[model samples]
Target: MTTTTELSELTGDYVLDSAHTRIGFVAGAAMVTKVRGQFDEFEGSAHLDGDDPSQSSAQLTIQAKSIQTRNQRRDDHLRSKVFLDVDNRPTISFISIGVEQVDETNFKGTGDLTIRGVTKQVTVDFELTGTENDPQGRFRVGFHGKATINRKDWGVSWGRGLVSEKVTLEFDVAAIRQP
Candidate 1:
C-alpha cells in the first residue's frame, strides 16, 4: 500500500507498460448480451506532478486497426468505414485537458478523446491501485479507470437497435518511471 506522502514522491515522467496495460471496452449487443473487445496496439506517456496533482497529464495513441473482439468478422466490421474507418483514420487518441485528485487514491481526468475523426470531451475516474518495484528494479505505478460514452458521439453509429449506443471504456494501466 502507498501512502499519500509516498504518492507525492512518485512524481516523474513515465511510459506506459503496454505489455501490462489493457485498453478495453464493453457494449450491449442485441439488447440481450454484451460484447467485449480491446485494442492490441497503443502507446502512452504521462507526467506526474504528485505534489501538484493538477499539473499531471497524459497522452495516448491507439491503432484503430488493432481492435480485437474474439470474432474476426466483427473485428473486420469495426475497421470498416461504417465504424472506425482504419484506412482513412488510422488511429484513436486522447490528451488530458485537466486532472483533479479526488482523494488519496482516486482521481478524475478530463480529456479530448478522438475517434473516427471526431473529438469529444470525456471524463474518466481512476483509482491508484498501487506502486511497486518490479523484479527488474523498475519503479511502476498502477491505475484503473472506466468511462461511459455514447458511440454516436464519435460517429460510431453503425449498429443502432442491434447494438446499444452506450459503450463503456476501461483502462488497466501500469506505468514505469523513466530514469
Candidate 2:
C-alpha cells in the first residue's frame, strides 16, 4: 500500500503498460442496446508532477485500425471511409493542455483529442485507484477515467438514427514509472 505522501513523492516520467491498460468506448446502438469496442494497440506517456499537479502532462496515440468490437464485419466497417477512415487517418491522438487535482484521489485533465482528422477539446475526470510494485520490480500506478463525446463532432456521422451521437470514452490505465 502507498501512502498519500508516497504518492506525492512519485514524481517522474511513466509509460502506459498497454498490456494491462484498456482504452475502450461505449455507444448506443439503435436507441436500444449499446455497442462496446476497444483499441488493441496504443502507446502513451506521462510526466507526473505529484507535488505540483498543474505541471503534469500526458499524451497518447492509438492505432485506428486496431478497433475491435468482437464482430469483424462491424469492425471492418468502422475502419472504412464511412466512419474512421483508417487508411487516411491511421491514428487517434490526445495531448494534455492542463491538469488539475480535484482532491487527494481525483483529478481532471483537459486536452486536445484528435480523431479521424478532427481535433476537439475534451476533459476527462480520473480517480486514482492505487499504486504497487509488480513482480518485475517496476513501480505502477492505476487510474480510471472517462469522458463523453459526440461522434458527429469528429465527422463520424454515418449511421445517424442507428448509432447514437454520444459516445463515452473509458480508460483503465496502468502506468509504469521509468528509471
Candidate 3:
C-alpha cells in the first residue's frame, strides 16, 4: 500500500467496500469517560476529478439501526426515539458540497450531514493513506477522515448529563475504483 501514486491516475468513480471500511464515533460519557461505537452497515461512492481537486465529490449513507456499542441494551435504546430513532429515520447521510487539497496527501471536504432528518454543515479532514492493487486485481484506495458534531443539534439530547453533546465521527474508508 503505497500512497505515492500520482493523483491524476486516480480519477474515476469508486464504490465503498463496506466490509473493509468502518464508520464510527466517540463521545464523552458521564463527563469522565468515553463511549465508542460504529455503524456496521454503510454504502458510499466518490467521484474523483484528479485534475481538479475542487471537482471531487463523495456521498455516504449509514444505517441508523446498525449502530453497536458492544452492549445490546444500550444499543436498543440508541435505536429508539431517544437517539437515532431508527424506526422513524433509518438512515444518516452526507453529501459533499466542496473539496480542497490542503497538500499532496491531505484534503478537506465541506458538506451537509443529515441525521434524524436534521441537516447541518460539517467539514471532514481526510488523509489519503494509500492506493494499491489487491489480490483480486481490483484497484483499491484508502482514506481516513474525521469530523465533530453536536448530538443535540440533531435532536439527540436525552443524555445531557450522562453523555456529552459533542461527538467525534471517524471514517476508515476503503474504496474500489470502477472498471
Candidate 4:
C-alpha cells in the first residue's frame, strides 16, 4: 500500500544563488528625482516546511558598503557620517521568526531587521512562483518579496525634504533543489 507523508516534511534548506537575485530600493523626490540603489553583496536563505508552514524561516545579510546609488558622488556622501557610515556599521540583516499566509502564493512574515547596529521589527511580503525542473533535472523554487521601511527608523535619517521618507524595498530570489 502507498502512503502519503505530511507537507511539513517537504521542508528543506535552500542555498541562495546571488546570480539570480537582487535586493533594491526606490524612492522619489520633487516629482522628478527618483533615487534608486541596490546592495551588491548579500546572502539569503529560506527554510520552508510545507506541511507546517509555521516551521518556515528566512534570513538575509547585506553589506552596507555595497550600496550603489549610481552616482559616485552621491554614493560617497551616503557612506559618510551623515548617512550609512559603512566604515563603522558594515552589515544589515533580517531574520524571520514566523510566516503568515495571505493566499496560496502570498504571505507575510514578521522579522527583525538590523541596520547600522539598530534593529527593528519588519514585515516582509513574499510570493511563491511555483517550482520547476532545470535542464540538469534539478528542482527549483522561486519567490519574490517586498517590504517598506523607514530609513529613520533604523537610524538612517540622513534624508532632506527633497528625499522621500518611505523607501520601497524589494527582493527577487530563486533556490535550486539538489537530489
Best candidate according to lDDT = 3
All candidates: TM-score = 0.97, 0.97, 0.98, 0.88
Q: Report the C-alpha lDDT of model 2 over 50-78, residue by residue, as the tens digit.
A: 98999999999999999999999999999
Of candidates 4 and 1, the better by lDDT: 1
The regions of model 2 sitting more than 4 angstroms off are 1-6
Overall local distance difference test of candidate 3? 0.94
Q: Tell me how far the alpha carbon of residue 150 in candidate 2 is from the true structure, in angstroms, after superposition.
A: 0.6
Give the poorly placed runs of model 4, Cα more than 4 Å off: 1-10
Worst 10 residues of 2 by lDDT: 1-10
Q: What is the number of residue pairs that collide in model 4?
A: 2
* lDDT, candidate 2, at 160: 75
> What lDDT tens digits, residue by residue, belong to model 4 across residues 145-176?
88988888877766578777788888887776
lDDT for 9 (candidate 2): 64
lDDT of 3 at 173: 94
lDDT of 3 by residue, 1-179 (tens): 98856899889999999999999999999899999999998999999888898999999999999999999998999999989989999999999999999999899999999999999999999999999999999989999999999999898989869999999999999999999
Could you tell me which residue pairs clash in candidate 1? none
Candidate achieving the largest TM-score: 3
Shift in Å, residue 72, candidate 2: 0.4
List candidate 1 segments past 4 Å from native.
1-5
lDDT against the true structure, per candidate, is 0.93, 0.94, 0.94, 0.79
Decide which is better by TM-score, 2 or 4.
2
